[model samples]
Target: MTITIERTRTAPQPTRQQPAADPKPATGSFQTVQPDLEVTAPLGERYDEILTPEALAFLARLHDRFAHTRHELLAVRLQTRVDAANGRDPKFLPETEWIRNDTTWRVAGAGPGLEDRRVEITGPTDRKMAINALNSGAKVWLADHEDATSPTWANVVEGQLSLFDFLRGNLEYTSPEGKEYRVTASETPTIVFRPRGWHLVEKHLKFHDRAGRAMHASGSLVDFGLYFFHNAKALIEGGRGPYFYLPKLESHREAKLWNDIFTFAEEELGIPHGTIRATVLIETIQAAFQMDEILYELRDHCAGLNAGRWDYIFSIVKTFRSRGRRWVMPDRKQITMTVPFMRAYTELLVQTCHKRGAHAIGGMSAFIPNRRDPEVTERALAAVSADKRREAGDGFDGTWVAHPDLIPTARAEFDAVLGERPNQVDRLRDDVQVTAAQLLDIPSGSGEVTEAGVYDNVSICIRYIESWLRGTGAAAIDNLMEDAATAEISRSQVWQWLHDNTVTAEGTRIDQTSIVRIMAAAVADLPRFEGDRFDDAISVFRSVALEPEFPTFLTVGAYARFL
Candidate 1:
């Protein structure tokens, strides 16, 4: 059935079940939790293939065993942030110093289909993008269900279905303009799926706990559970194990939680232990200091680490945006991979991952090629080429690109580095010595916050939020790929600049009055459509960017209200 979403075309929602009212809490173990959990979203065609009873039961089991731990870790994150905000600054952990000092341990290096991740195209797992990614000639496809996807119930459910169909060799798509495309390629890229981060919840699925209390299901469990439950065996049979890109983890404890989940999932499904491989994104400030411990905790199943640069910057702001002008940063474009602070982070990451036999993947540049403008495309290619070359030369085994157009450029850079080899993990980069001060150096970069920077942040944040509220998470704006991660940095910078009372190079002070004028101009400049959500976007931007207290994530609040 065609469901009427507030879009130009119909978007299908998931198939829901109105289970009998069961207010009773669950007993010990997952049996009780699985039966009482309810799927509240309405249904659509072929939804049963993904939302089967078995899948929900598996999902509930994951929640049952690990939900409390997830909550506790989230609490630790809040306290840690609070501590930073209150002048309790962070340093390398004294307690886990043993893990860092011990240099003998190593992660179970690249599994099949993951060895040569030289050029990975990162995007949402929607049909069109999935097909483009698979056929993009990249070595790996970061099948993203996290920031790149709008977490509508349809997107959540259909993403699994799309991956399932692609794995089964039956996936295809046709444009509304009557062009048909099949998911065929000379060699499909290795698929590494990214589940949502731990901080959010899947409100559509309500779980009743032992206390007889109903709460939202864990988004991580829902996304990972459905995907793993349905396709683990098939993936193993097809020469690829179930791989994951874990996002926004704050500590080694969180890594241990995922390691435990992987172990349990392998056993429950009769797969051999260590069949699951995960590459954790060191997005948050806390996780940056725990790289060695994180790899150690997941050594049995760990594959590598990725420098989630956009969120890393946003994480820094969220942690210390309210402190003072000393912690205040410059424009977003100014913080490149070569910056002293970012260089320390990436160097330390490479050192830690290489010491433990894991791939060090670089971050995406976000400068996607604009096809309509040849000069813009040329400039984007140059920018992306420079970015990828820096990573390739700096001892990274692989890197990520947002658009398929940049795959050749990224691969060329890595190809020049690793001509006949799959990766350079053996290059331990032991000469790279980093300290806590270098990693947390807030005053290193040199750039001024200009009026142009302020306008860019406000307009980009509003434009991105509008697209997201319209059910499109990823969009092209100003010759770059703008997703939830980039949007977070954009809005956070606006908030950070305004909160710190930043003055531009022209001596223009960033205050509520200036922000309002900029936001009004941004909204008015957009091409108005009948179903646009600019109003809601403005409200979301206002709440997250201009509010007194920071919301941990912009998507969490906007998703609750709009999606």
Candidate 2:
């Protein structure tokens, strides 16, 4: 099957507007004073009165290591090379510049045609089930590795290696009819893989080559990209394609790093650079902040970014846990592409990418249930339809479906959404002429920073907690936390800072004085949650100390005395 790229006139175009002059970087002497207000400790004398000495010491060690991890050495090297090659300053394009000057960028807009794109996952016994799903007109088939797969490390290694075997027609399996079935090399539904997370699960996938040398050298970054590279030949030869859904990306740097790796793989393996497509999950709060950068970094190789709902929610809560009551729990339903900020973010993403002539695909409709419940399926289909309607209205080219059962429903909904003619009359509306700059510049409480022009204090506090949890460094800034809603921005900043400062798993030169100040302030002002009673203070302190900037002397001393 030949994949055709269609150019639609209904594609979004930039509205007419006067472009503003480029913004000059802020200068002049600004007051550098930290906020000086003081409050009594909510926990009173009991605040520092919680954990055992050993726990406190462990926390200190953990914090020290996290604050000093070398997370971005390779990324820095690659970036330096790219910058030197381009012979340009490496300063990132400002968000405002991207919004105002980039007129060619189009937001994801409704298209007239919708190619039915549904994905189904098949297992060892369910090859026929998968083929049936594909025959039913599903556009994509994602072979599982993370969730739907139950393969152990050995099996995973074997399965991956056997992929080439099957694709090459060297391997055959017996069908239910007692006949041998062989895979014919032919283009079919787009095949993609959802691999295991890098942190915990990737270790299990290992394969040795014919020379008794490991195909993936242990602890090599090449291990991550090589698996795909080695199989590229088989994939293309077998009539499938090369594509992947990358998970657990922490920031744009990660995306860019992957892009560089992919570039290397393509060049080394003699495959076309754009042939292999990648869809990164903007799951973590940090990933969201760097969405534009990430997209831009991987623009040529990227299919699109997916809004991972559950992981994203978990990221938000984890990032802002220190903000206590001030942090609002995001309503999952309301917080999707429909929510104001999210809508703006998604719209901005669409606009930025489309302006550059890239696809702005929507994320998953995770509400779809199993095939066993027709009522649930009906409701899910309705929800999918509503979501597609919204996405169509907003101009998204495509969306994702989590379950195989929902593939048909999702494809149908998208098809229905695409069938409608672009309302030329609607295009003539005043709102249609409003530039993205104006839309983004619509003043709201969400943009407020402190006098320091940093994020709000609560937001900073939340970021501190999150960074600490992740074993990263912390700094207090009043304005950084105002819009705690976009946890990605806050978390990414912390990660960037950690990366820049050479934070490692080993200890760093932490500012003990700054730590004391932050601890005293947090202990004084922040309210204790339930279970943060006197008895829990030691435990909490120990946990918090494990953060990058835990008040080492004070925490250690307190724990020793308490124990």
Candidate 3:
């Protein structure tokens, strides 16, 4: 049975079906929360292969079982942030000290295609991109739907269809200019899907709660459910099972929730237990402090841990936005891996992951080479080589890239270190000792906020949000793959600098007056678009970056406005 969306190319929206909110729970051990499924946008050609009744029903089952837990966890996140903003600071969890102290337990061995992830290219699941990524010669492709994808109904549904086709060896695309792209089976990277973070919700699919009031489904579950429901068996039967890159995890309890969801899904689908493996991104400041415990919670299904450097910085800003000038960050460019605080985070991550026998993956190098300029390309390649060399020397099993061109550079670095070995999990970095004080030291930057930097932030945020509103999450700006993380850090630095009323190195004080002028200039500088996406982007940026209270994520507010 085909379940195509009602597509409208201009602004594709899911069709509406507001089923009367039933005030009572359904009968049986599981109270069935039947969602009023609506295909708001037109499902493009061949979408039926993924949006079938069976697939939606499978997602519904996942929602019925785990939706409540997801809500409670979100509540916990809110309260936790509130506490941090209200003077309660994040530190090592004493309660889960036992999990951290236990050194004997190890995560299940790397399942299938995850054994060698020396170079992973990350991008959205667009049709041509999907085929190109698979044939990118990288060891793994992070099929991203989270920060890297704009969650328009069309993008959400079509991305699923694209992955479905790739998995079945039926994926191919021709560009608007008539360039053919097809997946090369020989060079195809093992696919690892990165679902949206837990904080967001899929507003179109409204499922009733126990009280029978309609509510949006969890974005994490929607992405995970649809993918797992349809392709788990096929993936397992082939070389690799279903693998995931879990993002924005803030606590070990959240990790436990994911492990439980995986167990339940495996049982329901009759797949063998432990077939699903996930690499958790320790993005939030809170998660960085609990890396060991996070691994312990998902040890049964954990593949490893990734140092999500960009969001980690964004989290530091959000968590301490209202704190004194001590937490005020300098320019975003000043914050690098070499900084004492960042070094503490990455070193601790490797120590924690390797001590527990899990792969310690490095953060992303978001440099896109400019092929037209030989000098520019050479400089970019040198920077990428240096970054990967540092990671390999520091005991990271692998590193991630935003473009396919950097794969050779990254792989060569890891290969030089690994020789014939797939990974260096055995090289436990016992020499690294990180303290809480060092990790919390936010003074590594020069404390120089320049007006140029501020204007740059405003422009990038506006440009990024404009692209995002137009259904592109990953935008190429200044030869970098700028995702939500970039925008988050950008808007966040502005807010932080403003809250502290920081004076730029050029003697310009950052205040509302200066910011409004910058905003106006940014809007004027934007290229003409025939739609209100530009205006909406400006409003969203101002609201999030200039508001009295900081929103957890810029994407959360913008998601409601756009998608």
Candidate 4:
């Protein structure tokens, strides 16, 4: 589905209704009430409400003071609007309909064709890495200020300072191969910088231009406010990219707030309204429940939603940790895509996005291994391909790749899936039948567990069980309980779990073992079936698990098994 929104220019409309009466005085100093009716407080208590008559008269007398303050605020807002309009808002380009409609800005909507497409390049630092990622072929490359790279106050300041430099074509960086690359003033890619947390705006102001001006001098660049200030010709002349991926979103309000801010920024920046695009991550259970509302909030601007696997799992565990015995753990392998709720969430995302003429994108394939090992690379590539295939089959337009080596595999997977018609499989409906017992088992200790100490043991047990079932190789638990090659693939499955949790000298944790165990568990948990049919299905599961790697079916299988 393709979504095209036209940008329109318009003045700002009042967001709140006028208050009926002046606000009453507070205990000591006078306080104003919020103008909105929803503010339950009495008049004069809310910030936007006018104070008592005396206070109002006094405020009237200080018209000049208020005017001065108002003018200053307007100036700051205007500057921010300009910056945001021009795509120089520091952290991200403010997404608004106007920005999207601006004749100067053009964003190539990347869909299934570009899902697995990535161009690998190196940069000297995280900033450089960002620039290179943009230049590299992916439609969006997150300048991770959050996880992959560590940036201190100085780094943040320098990075912001370097934005203009990057735009002006004066950025240089050395690749890992020791090759130096320079970006001149005329070259710019679709770039987005992940800023420090909203609370750290003060620290981001340390670096300024040659005149010793702070980047955030007007206080317009606070807490995503930067996306509004830099909207002007100076920035857009290079290129106005109207998109952003909002990470770590925990509620519908956050999405709604962004929508409101974008609405205001569009008007202030003179950009066409509704041009900016955003993608919110469903990383927490709160976000999961609010998905419908959150997506509704940004329907016009939203590109799609992503299934944030690891963080989502972490959130589930955290949200339900207090339940004690009621808490059942998710299978490690199934954690990525298999939880029934997660599957439901993903399907809802896809359905919502498609319904809105948007493209649903998948989350990261973190299992892709290092590039140095040929065997690892091949395995990683195969796994990535399978994942992409599953995502495509599941109606996702794209997926994420952490390492460059997985790029080709991801692309191929997307291509293969895209080549097939969507909705081809009758069983591909988003809904899956799950019983109450299955739901209960989701948090059971015997189910997939996430407790810190038990992860290794559970993982090992799962892998060993699968291996034994495969009848290919023997598997042992803690170097004991060795099972000779047997038709019981369940034992080998246990070994597979152990392998997934095994910590190598290189510090890389592979999920292959977990994958096998998940498959075995699924086979073991199949519904009551007599003789041949059950045995045949179990054999197929064992064969797939014994294979090097499979697609993201672990989640589906595990969820089914749990059910």
Query: Which is the leading candidate under lDDT?
Result: 1
Report how far off residue 238 is in candidate 4 (Å). Answer: 5.1
C-alpha lDDT score of every prediction, in listed order: 0.86, 0.42, 0.85, 0.43
Across residues 1-563, which tens digit of lDDT does each residue of candidate 4 receive?
A: 21111111222242221112223433555343322101112222122212223222221222211223433444553454344334331221124333323333222223222222122121212345555555555544554433232233333334444454555555666778998766532333344433322212232222222121222221112313333243233445644544555655654556765676556555645766665666676765556655556666776566557676655655444343333434434334444465565666677666645544455668766543544567865765676677678777787776766544556677666567665433222223435343324422434334443432233433343443344223212233332222211112222233343334533333434366544454455446444433223443444444434444431222124212321
Better of 3 and 4 by TM-score: 3
Compose the digit string of candidate 2's lDDT tens values, residues 327-441: 3332223344554445655555555444544455566554535456678657767877787677655655566654455666656655665655322112211223323333222
How displaced is residue 15 in candidate 2, in Å? 55
- Candidate 4 to truth, TM: 0.52
Question: Which regions of candidate 4 deviate over 4 angstroms?
Answer: 1-125, 149-151, 174-179, 183-189, 192-223, 231-240, 328-334, 367-369, 419-441, 444-563
- Residue 78: error of model 1 in Å? 1.0
For model 1 the TM-score comes to 0.94
Candidate 2, residue 177: how far the Cα is off, in Å: 13
| lDDT value for model 2 | 0.42
- Indicate which candidate wins on TM-score: 1
Q: Rank candidates, TM-score, best first.
A: 1, 3, 4, 2
Better of 1 and 2 by lDDT: 1
- TM-score per prediction, in order, is 0.94, 0.50, 0.93, 0.52
The local lDDT score (0 to 100) that residue 553 gets in candidate 4 is 24
Off by over 4 Å in 1: 1-35
Stretches > 4 Å off in candidate 3: 1-42, 529-532
Clashes of each: 3, 35, 9, 81
